[model samples]
Target: MSIFHLMLSSVVIFFVLYAPQPLLAQFAQLYATSPANTGLLMSVTMLPLAIAPICYGLFLANYSKLKLLKVAMMLLALCSVLITLQQRFELFLLLRFIEGLILPAALTAMTSYIGQTWQGQCLRRNMTWYVGSTILGGFLGRALAANFATWWNWESFYIFNAALLILISLRIKLPPLENITTPKACSPKDYLRPLKQPSLLRLYCAVFCMFFCFSALLNYLPFILSNEYNLKDPKLIGWVYGGYLVGALLSMCAPYLTKLHNNNWVILTAVFGVYCVSISAMQWQNLGAFIVLFTLFCACMFIIHASAAPLANEISSAHASITNGAYVSFYYSGGALGSFLPGFIYQTAGIEMFLLSLLLICILGAYFTWLNYRIGSETQLGR
Candidate 1:
C-alpha cells in the first residue's frame, strides 16, 4: 500500500513538473506572445515553488503528512481543470501560481512520509521510483501533447492530467499520520541555524548552481532547436527529451556509485565534465550530435539532483525539514533565474557564450562540492 501510494504520488509530481513544456508552444500561440514571454509562464509557477517550500517547512511542520498530501493532490487536480478552461494568460498564470503553493506542500509531505515508512534499501528503491516517475511524467506529458494535439486540443493535456490525479487519489491509501509539532511552531531563529554550518552552506550553493545549469538547458533547448535548427515537430522535441531516460537510469545507479568512492567527488567530477562537454556539443548543428550531447547532459543532471537532495538532508541532521526547505528554495530560485537569464544571454551574447557561462557556474559548483567533502570528512573524523 505504501509503494502504491508512493507511485501515485510520483505520477502526480511527474505531471506537475513536465506538463508545462509542450504547453510553452501552445502558450505562445494562445497569448500571441514571444517565446520569452511564454517562458515566464513557467517562471510564474517556479516563483511560488521557490518560496512556498520554506513557508510550508516553517509554518506547517506539524500538519498530517498524509492528509496534506491527499488534499494537495485534489487541489492540484482542481487547478489543472481550471487552468485548462482559461483563455487569458494572466488567469492561467494565477492558477499556476496557486498550484505552485500546493505542490511544495505535497512534496514535503511525500518526503516526510517516505522517511517515516521506509529505510535502507527500501528507501533507496522508492526514491529511484520517484525519480523515474518524474522523468516518465515528463515523457508522457510531452508525448501526449505532441501526438494528441491533432485529435483534441492543448487543453486536453490538462484534462488528461486531472483524470490521472483523480484516479490516484481514489486508489491510494496513505499511511496514518503520526503526532508531531509543526515546524511553523518553531521560532524563526531556529530555522536560521542550519545556514551557519559551512558544509550546509556549500550544499545549498551547489544545489543552486546545479539547478541553474539544468533549468537553463531545459528552458532554452526547445527554442534553440526550433529557431536555429528549424525543427517544428513537437514530437521530435519530445524525443529529444527522451534523453531523460538516461538520467533516470543514472539516478538509480547513484547508490552503487556511492559505495565505490566518495559520492561528493564523483558527482562533482561528473558535473564539471558534463558542463564542459555540453558547451562544446552545443556548437554542433547536427541533430544526431545534438541528441547525444543532450543525453549526456541529462545524465549528469540526474546524478547531481539524486546525490544533492540526500546530502542536504544529511548535513542538516536534526533540522532536516528546514534545511531541505532552504535547499529547495535556493534550488528553484536558481531555476527561476535560469529560465529568464538564458533568454537574456541569448539576446545579448551568442548561444556558445551562454553555454560557456553555465560551464563557469558548473566549475564553481565543483569547487563547492569539494569544499563540502573536506569539511564533512573533518567533522566525521573529529567525532
Candidate 2:
C-alpha cells in the first residue's frame, strides 16, 4: 500500500510537471508570442527544477519527507488552478516558475522516503516502479491535456489535474519522519565536490546533451505538426505523443541491455549513436515516418537515461544522494535550455536545421560516453 502511494506520488508529480508540453502550440497562439518565446512556458518551469535538487539535498536532508510532499502537491494544485485564471502571459510564466521551485521538493521527498522505507531488492523494485509511473505520468499528462483542451477548453485540463493533486495530497501515506534515521547535513561545498571527479563529470556532460536533444525535439514537435504538416487539431496532436509509451517499456529493458554488454559506456555510446540516427530519420516529410522515427527516438533516449542514472551512483557511492542531485541538475539544465533555444532554429531556419543542431549535440554526447569508457578502463587497469 505504501509502495502504491509512492508510485501514485511519482505519477502525479510528473503529470503536473509536463502537462503543459502538448499545449505549447495553443499557448503560443493564445498568448500572442512567437514560437521561440512561447517555449518559456516550459523553460521557466525547468530552470527551477535544474537548480533546486542541490538545495534539497543540502538543506532538506532531515526534513519530513511526507510533510514536504503533501505541501508541494497542494501548492502545485493551486498553481494549476491559478493558471486557469491567468490572462497575462508574464504572470503565466511566473506561475510556471513557481511550479518549478515546488517540484524538486516533491521529487526529493518521494525519493528520500523510498530510501528510508525500504532496502535491498525491495528498494530496487520500488524504484523501478517509480520510474515507470513517472513515464506513465509524462505520457498521460500530454495525451490527456491535449484531449481535454479539444473537448472543452485549455483550462479544463488544469482543473482536472488540480482535483487529482488535491486528492493525492490528502490521501497518500508515508512513515513518519522520526522513524527514519537522519542523514548528516551536507554543506554547500558538497554540492560542487562531484564536479571534481572526471568520470562523473563526463557522465554528467553526456546526459546533458542527451536530454538537451530530447527536450528540443519534444518541446517543438507540436509546432512542426501544426505549422508544417498543417495538422491543427489538438486531439490529433496529442496522439502523436503516443510514441512516449515506447519509452516507458524501453526503460524497463535498460538493465537487461546492460547485462548484454560488459562495458556499460560502450552500450551508452552505441545507444546514443542510434538516437542520432533515429532523429536524423525524422527529417522525412511524411508525418507517419516522423511518428515511427519518434518512437525509436524515445526508446533510445530512455535507455540512455535508465543506464546513466545508476551509473552515476556506481561512480560515486559515498555521496550517492548528492551525486544523483547533481545529475538531476545537469540533466534538467539541458532541458531548461533545450526547451526554448531550439525554437529559434526551428522558427527561423526550419525543422531540418533544428534536427541538425540536435544531431551535432548527440555526436558530442557519444564522444563524452567514449571518454567515460576510456577513463574507467584506465582506472581499472591501475587498480
Candidate 3:
C-alpha cells in the first residue's frame, strides 16, 4: 500500500476505536445514569471487541485482507449512523456492542497489511502514526462533542466520523494479503498453545494489567476531574486530554529506543517504574503537579503499548495473525473488566482504595516484566 493509503487506514482505525469515550459522560447525563452505568456504553463495545477477533481469525484465514477491511469499515459506518438514531438505552448499548464486532476484522486486516508490507523502522513509523491517530481521534471526538454542543448536537460527532470513514473507503487502495488455505488443522487446544510459553504468558499478563489500569483511568478521569477538581468546562477536558500528544510522540520514539536496548527493559523501566511514580503523584491536587504527572503516566503507557505490541507479534511467528488477534482480544477484554471494576471498587471503598488497587496491579506487571526478561535471557544463553 502507498504511504497515504496506510496513513488514511490508520486514521479510520483510530477513530473507530476511540470515538466513543468523550461521549460517555454526555450519554450518562442524557440517560440520568451513574458513572458506573455509563461505563456500560464502553463495556458493551469491548465484549464484541474481544470475541470478534478470534472468530475472524478463524473465518478469515482464507480471505483477502483488503476485502475484509472494506466490509468491516462499511459495517462500522453503518453502525455509527445507527447509534445516532437510537433513543433508548438498550438500543444504544446494543448498537455499540455490534459496532465492537465490526472492529476486530478491520483491526486484524490493518495489522496484517502493515506486517506484510513493512518491517523494522518502516513498520515502527507506520505504527506510531497509527497510535497518534488513535490519540487524535479520541481527543478530537470528545472535544468536538463537548465544545460544539451549541453548534449542532452530540450526534454530530458520529456524523463526522461516518463522513471520515466514507472518505477513506473511497480513496485508500489496500494491497492484497496472503490467503491461508489447506492449512494444518489447529484445534482450539492448539490456539491455546501460545499461552504455554512463559514469555508469552508474561507478556499477556502485562497487557492485561496495563490495559486494566489505563481503562480505569480513562473511564473515571472525567468524573474525577469534574467532582474532585470542580472543573466544568468541556474545553478544559479536551485540553487535559491533549496530554496524550506527549504519548503520541513517545510511541513514535519506540523504534529508536528498541535499537538502543531490549524492548523488555524499556517496558520494565518506562511502563512499570515511571508509571507507578506518576500514579502516586496524582495524590497532589495542584494543577501543575497533576498535569506533569498525567503527562508522564501517558508517556510511559505509550512506551509499554508500543514495545509490547510488537513483542506479542514476535512470540509466535508461525501464527502471527492469530497471535496478534489473541493479544488484542486480551487487551480489550482487560479494558472491559477495567471499566467496571473501578466503579465497583470506588462505590464500595473509595477513590483512594481504587487507586491503591491500581498501584498494586502495576507492581505485579513490573514483576512479570522482570520474569520475562530473565526467561528470555536464559533462553538466549542456552541457544
Candidate 4:
C-alpha cells in the first residue's frame, strides 16, 4: 500500500501537469492566441515546478515530509477544482500557478519517503517503478485529456484528475521509516549543498539537456502532426501520444538495463543515440514513421531518466530529498525551456528545423553523459 500510494502520486503529478500539452493548438485557436502564448499555459505549470522545489527543499526541510506531502496534495486538489470550474482563461492560469507551487512539496516528500524506507537494490527497483509510474502518468494524462476533451469537454480531464487526487490524498498514510534523515531547518547552505558535488553537478547539466530536448519535441509534436498531416481533431492527435506508453514500458526496464551493462553511461549513450536517430527521422514527414520514432524517443528519454535518478540518490550523501529536488529543478527547467522555446523556431524555420534542433540536443546530451562518466569515474551504477 505504501508503494502503491507513492506510484499513485507519481501518476497524479504528471497527469495533472502535462494534460494540456496535446491541446496547445486547440488552445491557440480557441483563444486566438499565438502558439507561444498558448505554450505558456504549459510553461506556467512547469516553471513553477522547476522553481518551487528549491524553495520547498530549502524552507520545509525540517518538517514532517509525509504530512507535508499530504498537505501539498490537498492544496493541489483544491487548485485543480478551481481550475476545472473556472471559465476565464486568466483565472485558470492563476489556479494552475498554485497547483505548480504545491507539486514540488508532494514530490520532494515522496523522494524523502522513499529514501527513508528502502535500501540498496531494493530501493533501485522500487524507484524504477516509481519512475515508470511517472512516465505512464505523463503518457496517460496528455493522451487521455485530448481524447476526453474530444469526447466531452476540454475540462473533463481536469475534473476527473481533481477528484482522483482528493481520494488518493485521503488514503495515503505515511509510515515511520528507518535510515531517513530529515533536515532540522532550511538555510542557504542547505539549498546549495547539492551544487557542491562535481559528478552530481554534471548529472544535473545532463538532465537539463535531456528534458530541454524532450519537452520541446513533445510539446510541438501535435502542431507538426496537425499542420503537416492535417490531424486537427484532438482524438486523432491523442493516439500519437500513446508513444509515451512506450516510454513508460522502457522506463520499467532501467534496473534490468543497468544489470546488463552495469554502467549508466553506456545506457545513456545508447538511449541518446536512439534519440538522435528517431528525432532525425521526424523530418521524413511519414506519420507512421514519425509516431514510431517519437515513441522510441520518449522511451529512450524515460529509460535514461530512470537510470539517472538512482545515481542522484546514491551520490547525495545526505539530504536525499534536497538533492532530488535540485535535480528536479534542473529537469523541469529543461522542460519549461522546451515548453515555450520551440514556438519561435517552429514559426520561423518549420518542423524540419525544429527537429534538427532536437537532434542537436541529443548529441549534446550524449557528450555531457560521456564527459561526466569519464571525469567522475563513478562506480558501475545501478548495481
Candidate 5:
C-alpha cells in the first residue's frame, strides 16, 4: 500500500510538472516568443527544483514527511488551478517556477515515505517501482496533455490534474514518518565532507552529465521531430515521447544487470555507449529506424540512472540522505541547464547542431562513468 501510494504521488507530481512541454509550439504562438523563450517555460521548473534540496536541508529539516507531503500536494493542486486560470503567459511561467519549489518536497517525501515503509530487498524493489512509476508519470503527463489538448485546450492538463491531485490527497494515508533530516548542529562542512571522497564526486559528475543529456534530448526532440519530420500535430508529437516507456521498462532490468555484472559503473558506461550510438543515428532521417534507436537510447539512459542512483545513495553510509540529496541537486542542475541551452543552440544553429551537442554530452557521460569505476577499483586494490 505504501508503494502504491508512492506511485500515486509520483504520477501526480510528474503529471502536473511536465504538462507544459508538449504545448511549447502553442505557447510560442500564443505568446509570440522564440523557441528559446518557450523552452524556458519547461526549464524554469528545474531551476528551483535544483535549488530547493539545499534549502530543505538548511531550513525545513524538521518537517515530518507526511506533513510536508500534505502541504506540497495541496499547493501542487493550487498551482495547477492557477496555471489553468492564467491567461497571461509570463504569469504562467512564474507559476511554473512555484511548482518547481513545491515539487522537491513532495518528491522527497515520497522517497522518505517508502524508506520508512519497507526494508532491505523490499525497499530496493519498491524504490525501483518508484523510479519506473515516475518515468511512467512523466510519459503520461505529456502524452495525455497533448492528446487532450485537441479536444479541450492546453489548460485541460491543469484542470484535470488539479482534480486528480485533490482526489489523491483526500484519500492517501501514511503512518507517521520523519524526514532524514540533518541534525541542526550539522554544519555545511560536515554535510559536504562526503563530497571530498573521490568516487562519490565522480558519481555526482557522471549523473549530472547523464541527466543533462537525457533532459536536453527529451526537451528538444519534439521541436526537431515537429519541424524536421513534418509531424507537427501535438497529439502525434506526444506519441513520439512514448519512447520513454521503453526506458521505464528497461529500468526494471537494473537489479538483474547489476547482479550479473561485477561493477555497476562498468555496466553504466557500456549502456552509455549504446545510448550515444542511438542518438547519433537520429541523423539518418528514417522515421522507423529513428524511433527504434530513440527507444534504445531511452533504455540505456534510464538503465544508467537506475544503477547510478543506488550507488550514489549507498556510497556514504553515514550520510546517505545528504549523498542522495546532493546527487539529485546535481541531476536537476543538469536538467535545468540542459533544458535551456540545447533549445538555445537549436534555435541559433540547427537541429543537426543540437544532435551534435547531445552526442558530446553523452560521450562525456560515458567517460565519467568509466572514470568513477576505475578510481573506485584502484582504491579497493590499494586498500
Candidate 6:
C-alpha cells in the first residue's frame, strides 16, 4: 500500500507537470504567440524545477516527507483550478509558475521517501516502479490534455487534474520512517556538496544532456507534426506520443538490463548510442519511421533515468536528499533550457539543424557516460 501510494503520487506529480506539452499548438493559436514564446509554458514550469534543490532543499529538509507531499499536492491542485479559470495568458503563465514552485516539494518528498525506505533489491524494485509510474504519467498528461482540449476546451483539463490531485492528497499515506535526509540543518552548500565527487558530476552532466535532448524533441514535436507532416488535428497529434508508452516498459526493464550488463555505465552508453541513432534517423522525412525512432528514443531516455537516479542516490547516501535534489535540479535544468532554447534553432535553421543540435547533445551525453565507465573501471582495478 505504501508503494502503491508512492506510485500514485508519482503519477500525479508528473501528470500535472507535463499536462501542457501537447497543448502547445492550441495555446499558440489562442495566445497569438510564436512557438518560442508559447514554449515558455513548458519552460516556466521547468525553470523553477531546475533550481528546485537549491531553492527548496532547506525547507524540505525539516518537514515530514509524507506531510509535505500532501500539502504540495493540494497547492498544486489549487493552481490547477486557478489556471482553469484564468483568462489572461500572463495570468496563466503566472499560475503555471506557481505550480512549478510547489511541484518540487512533492517530487523530493516522494523520491526521498523511496531512497530512505528501502535498500538493495527492494530499493531497485521500488525505484523502477516509481520511474515507470512517472513515465505513465507523462504519457497520460499529454495524451489526455490534447484529447480533452479537442473534446471540451483547452483550459478545462486542469479542472480534472485538480480534482484527481485532491483525491490523492486525501487518501494517500506513508508510514513514518526515520528521516535520514535532514542535516542538523540544511544549506544550499549542503546540496552543492554532492557535486564534488567526480563520478556524480559526470552522472549529473550526462543526465542533463539526456533530458535536454528528450525535452527539446518532445516540446517541439507538436509543431513538427502540425507543420511538416500537415497533421493539424490535436487528437492525431496526441497519438503521435503513443510511442512514449514504450518508455515505461523499458524503465521497468532497468534492473534486468543492469544485471545483464553488470554495469550501469555500459548500459547507459549503449542506450545513448541507440538514442543518438534514433535522433539521426529522425532526419529521414518519413512519419512512420520517425515514430519508430521516437519509441526507441523514449526507451533509451527512461532506462537511463531509472539507472542513473538510484545510482546518484547510492553514491551520495550520506546526503540522499541533497543528492536526489541535485539530480532533479540538473534534470530539469536541461529540460528548462531544452524546452525553450532549441526553438530558436528550429525556427531559424530548420528541423534538420534542430535535430543535428540534439544529436550533438546526445553525443555529449554518451561521452559523459563513457567517462563514468572509465572512472568506474579504474576504481574497480584499484579495489
lDDT of each: 0.70, 0.78, 0.70, 0.76, 0.75, 0.80
Q: Write model 4 residue lDDT over 162-183, tens digit each, in one string.
A: 8888888888775584333554
Task: Give TM per candidate.
Answer: 0.87, 0.83, 0.86, 0.87, 0.86, 0.88
The local lDDT score (0 to 100) that residue 212 gets in candidate 3 is 87
lDDT of 2 by residue, 312-361 (tens): 65555334445656777888888878877898999899989999999999
Candidate 3, residue 14: lDDT: 62
Segments in model 2 whose C-alpha atoms lie over 4 Å from true places: 22-39, 84-91, 112-125, 150-156, 178-186, 223-237, 283-288, 377-383
Give the lDDT of residue 322 in candidate 2.
59
Clashing pairs in 6: none
By lDDT, rank the candidates, best first: 6, 2, 4, 5, 1, 3
- The residue-by-residue lDDT of candidate 3 on 221-262, one tens digit each, is 777778778877967975777677776676667656765654
Write model 5 residue lDDT over 30-93, tens digit each, in one string.
8898877887787788788787765553333345666767778889999998887788879988
Q: How many residue pairs clash (N, CA or C atoms closer than 3 angstroms) in each of the candidate models, in the order given?
A: 4, 0, 0, 0, 0, 0
**On TM-score, who's better, 1 or 4?**
4
Itemize residue pairs with steric clashes in candidate 2.
Answer: none
RMSD of each candidate?
A: 3.1, 3.7, 3.2, 3.0, 3.4, 3.0
Could you say which candidate leads in lDDT? 6
**Candidate 1 C-alpha lDDT tens digits along 1-383:** 46666766776666766677666876788799887787666667778888888776655455666777778888899998998788788888788788777888877666655544555546555655665666666667666765667688877877888888878876656456565643443576776665688776776787788788888888788778887788879778767877877666766675555555545555555665665677567787788888888887777777777666655555454344566567678888888888778778887887877887888887787777767556656532111
> In candidate 6, what are the lDDT values of residues 1-383, reduced to their tens digit?
38898888788778898898778878888888887787678778877888876455555555677888888999999998888778888998898888888888778878877877777667777888888898888878877887888899977788888888999899966557645545563556664665698877888899999999998998789889887888899678767777788666866788787666666678778888998999999999998888888888998898889877877766663355666777788998898789778999999999999999999999999998888778756421111
Which is superior by lDDT, 1 or 4? 4
Candidate 6 Cα RMSD after full superposition onto the native fold (Å) = 3.0
lDDT of 2: 0.78
Which portions of model 5 miss their true places by more than 4 Å? 25-39, 58-61, 115-120, 153-156, 172-184, 226-239, 318-320, 343-353, 377-383
Which stretches in model 3 have alpha-carbon errors above 4 Å?
Answer: 24-39, 85-88, 147-149, 172-182, 186-188, 266-270, 378-383
